[model samples]
Target: MAWSYRKRIKLIPGVHLNLSKSGISTSIGVRGASITVGKSGTFLNTSLPVLGLHNRQRLSGPEPPSDPTSSPSDRILPLNQSRGNIFSSDVQEITSQNMQGVKEVLLLAHQQRKELNSDLLKTKASLGGSKVKLVISYLLIYGLIKRSIPEQIKSDIESQKEAIAQLQQAVEDSYVAFEIDFDQELKERYQKLVDSFIQLTGCAKIWDVTGAHHQDRKTTRSSASRLVEKREVRFSLKSLPEVKLGFDALCFQNANGADLYIYPSFVIMYSSKTNFAVIGLDELSLSQSYVRFVERDAIPRDTKIIDKTWAKVNKNGSPDKRFKGNHQIPVVRYGELILNTTTGLNEQYQLSNYEFTEAFGNAFRDYQAAIRGTKQR
Candidate 1:
């Protein structure tokens, strides 16, 4: 009766026994049994297995039945809201990182595109500049070729020294031949020659030979009367006075009725004893007043006025002195007077006194001599 080493325990819905001996202790509970013995009397309890354990005493009266349609797995745990939220956050982070990477790539691509575009523009600009330079060079070369080649050829052609010299000499000889003494007889001869040349060349329509005007009637009358009286008086005198003709002794008349009574082309202050006539081609009468009488060692070509004057006096005695006034004499070949006139019909029509004179030499004896040569030919 001193406590036998036996104990009874109830575990969940089952009963079991636990025993201890020799100063042993034991305990029983509804869930499990515990035992202790001697100095090592530590009681140990064992939990009942939760599976297939049912106790009527612990059951609450009439527990509600589970729905047959509900799945046991569905009821195993409630929705893990925090887990879902954590997953969503992780997904969002991953997506954001991908988007960021995409944005960076796009930015880099855009920058690359801009750089490429800039490089393209620069390359295009360089090409355009080169093209422009090439074009300019081509134009310059073309211009040089167009302008220089012909001029060089012409220079080469004209560089024949012997030919140029001969031409110059010929021009000089022709000019000298045209130079003539200024005299009234020469004037009349020149007029006749002009008329004859016009007729010979069938250039009557082109050549103008009519004198523009005459000396004043009173002056002409006085001059004539004085000359007659002087001749008569000289016949009576023991010795004739030396009459020195002044520069103003000559007169000029144009086909346009313009009359110029002025000094002879040069002064002829000659005494009656001197049979030799001192002729002068007035250099002052040139179109350019300062023109040198000689051009390239040759007397410059006579102008038209000079030719007219020569035509007027070809058959007359040489004047003591010759002077050119405003008119120029043209260069006329001995036999080419009429031909020149015919050929230069347009020039004649458009003739100014200056141009005419410039074309011909002094208009006195030179002009007349040219005409006479033509007549002889």
Candidate 2:
């Protein structure tokens, strides 16, 4: 006869086992008594019919159809009491396996997280470094521009200074060789020419008829007919490549301080053959004496050449009643030459427009030379 015992084990929530022994026979089955192991361990029984029957009872139960949908917790809860009867070592082994699996999964997840964090930190540092580089590059460019600005300004200022120096030198050179006393000669020559022209023309004069009839007629006639004449002329003399005489003298005031004069440095003479003739003086011969005359007397007197012309008076009035005398002739002062004629006398001269044009052209040509490259002193 043999004896048998049954045992049950629970592994986690989803697994279970039932073990039975009878004589020399052994078997294992699930909760529904479907045997998965049979005759494998101590289940061969030749005697002990009671133990065999008990074993058979332990193995026998209602047929268990496969339950593909049964949950592991549903299977496990029914075997909770049976688990106590199983080997503690086997239960501990199953629990350890589950715990090891969980730990491995958690550790893998933790390793992945640490790797991600490291990658994020590296990316952030790279971005920060790039930003720092960009800032430094901008600062370097700005510094270069700031350093260049002063040099550019200095170059511009230096160029301007050079231009100013050149202009100053040109002015000084133009005046360097000029003579001091040339204006005096010009004044004397101009006066002589004026006197000669006036006498040669034998122009009419205005006399007060009242003076002829007065008891003091002798003195009055003598004084009135004395023919006080004042003449002034100014012209430029810069067109001629070469000039013989320079400005001689500038007559600025008369003995009575009522007359003013300006010396001519240019002249134009009209003749039947040439039609127009131009004379020019050397700029190198213009004197400080002439400048003095302008400064001291002539400029202060504010005398103008137009005031001396016969055109100052009316043609229709008697000598005594009019503000200016009758017998007033019209004089066209062109450059240094005085064109003296009565209003109708110019018609007889038959001077062509081309002749006047040529004379004015020549005068302007010389005038340009005197002013060019020269400053007013």
Candidate 3:
């Protein structure tokens, strides 16, 4: 009988494999192996040596030393597409199947990871060059995680902008005006305005926007009644310097105290230097705030409105005088006694919810759409 010798077989144009006993072992390497040279060209896996895949050797001499200085891990190996550190005919067959989409790459990478962990638990893997393949698998997974992230985020943001524009227009179409007598109809209108303001601004309470730390109404009355009189309702975005201001006073925690020209159906707000008004309107009413317009714009930033002649004065200049039997409260107040929404407003700059909403909505809608449009791309 003749002794048989295994010969290297050419599988394809560039891929060749040795059928010898040790060839398969060296080709795959063990798990947790160090990273090796990148694959040739753009092929998924690195090349191996049956075909002398990499012509350039790391050694400088014609022959390798009897005792090599390099560790097994230091010797680079080909990256296998499968796990188990053994690339058999089965693995090759599985990879040949039609595969597409993002998860395909991730699934194979994750499978290989599980195989490596299984080997670790069983202590069957020395992992030397195998780690290099694991690294490639993880790299594929990492790439998939970030896929379409930036674009999807941009799409979500763009959708929100359109929602805002439509919401503003809807509010404008719903605005209703009122005169002196504050009735249930007026109250409903006021409530709707408050609702839309809360929904769009994300301020669940006045403090969320105003940063007011008052716990109860008594504390609120003491702190907030005089708040607008002081500079608490000033253009400063928030009561606390640490917090950012909202788009308008309605969004502020102390919406009643904010230095804005408020009304039952709408409020007009603007920067100190600009004549343009940013109007907040009732989504339930379709008109102007006719009862009266507040004129804080005419009042100085730190001025106070004296409605009652308090007999007592504190060091802080607050009058503690209560209304007596003969001496009644002042004709006007912006507090609980009345539903007046015109305090501190700029009457001269007042506009019906009708006039302002359409214009403001039109102008702002385009600007927002354009801004988000740039982000979408």
Candidate 4:
């Protein structure tokens, strides 16, 4: 749906806030590009640059016919002549004129957000103060393989951990990124995992999954060296492609989509809001699908069968025998990962409509940490 049109909470020009049931977010943009700023950061309506400079046209109503009868002062600005650009004097004039109004609207929205945040906090607390998010679910399974962490690998991770964190923060803002030394084989493997996730999720593009303010994104590595500590998999957005959606962010319905989709960290958030160290999976991970879990058992854990069978499909949504069964597929354990976030999701929710418990969470975490020369948190 065209949300901008549907959402009536217009603030200053090109600024809209949704305080409705859909969710809490400030959509700032006009037509061609918009960024929904929520508690989880921001999401884009178009894949523009960070500064939002682009030639792409926004969806607009047909232009009004020119009228010689109209006075010059009465005429509306032409679409192309509306403003110089995001940084031009024209845009400066517009912002100056609307600054007061913008501030007022934001102030009002912020108050409402505070109230709503309190309410949401109460609600989630009633259910559970802490939740074990099915962190690795949206990821592909093939990426979760790990072997013994070489001595060099351990030293590299410790030395570059700070750098890696900085790189993820930078990449999330837009296309900017940093190069880190890391294992090539690991990079190639992580790529497959992310690829599998996108294929199964039915998302239109990578931007839909993790773009900031709808800016462009990519996975890049410097052409520097190999067998080093920092690398693509370590620095890429895919590694930390997650936003914690706490009570503050869940006030809007739009925010729920990310809760269901998106690459996530398996970090446990306690009542104190302290996020446990994330357990990154390099091989097959265990996940519990709420929808599948619910549909299979209305009463919670009511599903009788221990090992249930389900149908399968190709990405096109058609039935295909190429899909393998649990018994048919070899259990690779730590040596290899069954990277299939998308495929398993298809089987549980779309095709078969059931959830498989990652009953292997603890063991898998130990294996993953050991292979990375780290301790499981």
Best by lDDT: 3
* TM-score, candidate number 2: 0.18
Predict model 3's lDDT versus the native: 0.25
Q: Write the per-residue lDDT of candidate 2 for residues 1-377, one digit (tens) a residue.
A: 11111211111111111221110111212132111111122132323221111111121212221222333222321111232221111211221211232222223333433443453354345445545544564576863556554344344344333333332332222110112232343334345544433332232211111111112323332211112122222222222111112433222111111111122432222221112222222111111000000111122121222312222222322233334453343222111111111110010011112223234323322332332322222
Which lDDT tens digits does candidate 3 get at residues 255-357? 3222333333223332222121322222111111111212333432222344442223333535444524323222112110001111122111111222232
Using all chains and alpha carbons, the TM-scores for the candidates as numbered come to: 0.14, 0.18, 0.15, 0.19
Best by TM-score: 4
Sliding window of 10 residues with minimal summed lDDT for model 3: 21-30
Each model's lDDT comes to: 0.24, 0.24, 0.25, 0.24
* Lowest lDDT 10-residue stretch of candidate 1: 228-237
Error of 1 at 326 (Å): 99
Candidate 2: segments with Cα more than 4 A from true spot: 1-145, 175-223, 226-377
lDDT, residue 191, candidate 2: 50
lDDT of 2 at 230: 24
lDDT of 4: 0.24
lDDT of 3 at 303: 24
Off by over 4 Å in 1: 1-95, 142-377
